[model samples]
Target: MFSTRPRDADAKQFIAEQKTLASIDQQVDAFHAAQPTAPDPVIIEHPIDPVLQTGDSQLLGGAMEIKSPWSEP
Candidate 1:
């Protein structure tokens, strides 16, 4: 015969375990709150142009050479 007594015991055990987990989560939250967080560092970098002119040659010349920054010099 099925009894409500066993179901009640299982419910009580589940509630106890849930409480234990909740206490652990609270402790972790408190520890994190106590620690101070630092701000991210600022990074500075030079912007690379897609096209780099190596020599004194002007675009007005009959023929000009264009080099891509990605190409090896």
Candidate 2:
């Protein structure tokens, strides 16, 4: 009787866990459905040219300084 009680308790816990997982899955599905689709990319006729090097004249061993466009000041 003691062994059966533990087994029954474990079974109930497993069922409860499964129900929680199912609820999460439903919420995720609903969220996905509510999201908007991505828009198409636009094409331009003439794109602006990118700057290759910095205007700094003084440098060690004549090495050019490279800078990233996304870097913050």
TM-score of each prediction: 0.46, 0.48
Cα deviation in Å at residue 39, candidate 1? 4.5
Off by over 4 Å in 1: 1-5, 39-73
TM-score of predicted structure 2: 0.48
User: Which pairs in model 2 have colliding backbones?
Assistant: none
Model 1, residue pairs in steric clash:
none
Tens digits of lDDT, candidate 1, 1-73: 7776778898999999999999999999999999977545544433433355334433333333443334345
Which whole-number lDDT from 0 to 100 does residue 60 have in model 1? 32
* 1-73: candidate 2 lDDT, tens digit per residue: 3564677889899999999999999999999999986544443333322343335522222333343334345
lDDT of 1: 0.65
Worst 10 residues of 2 by lDDT: 57-66
Candidate no. 1 TM-score? 0.46
lDDT of 2: 0.63
**In candidate 1, where is summed lDDT lowest over 10 consecutive residues?**
57-66
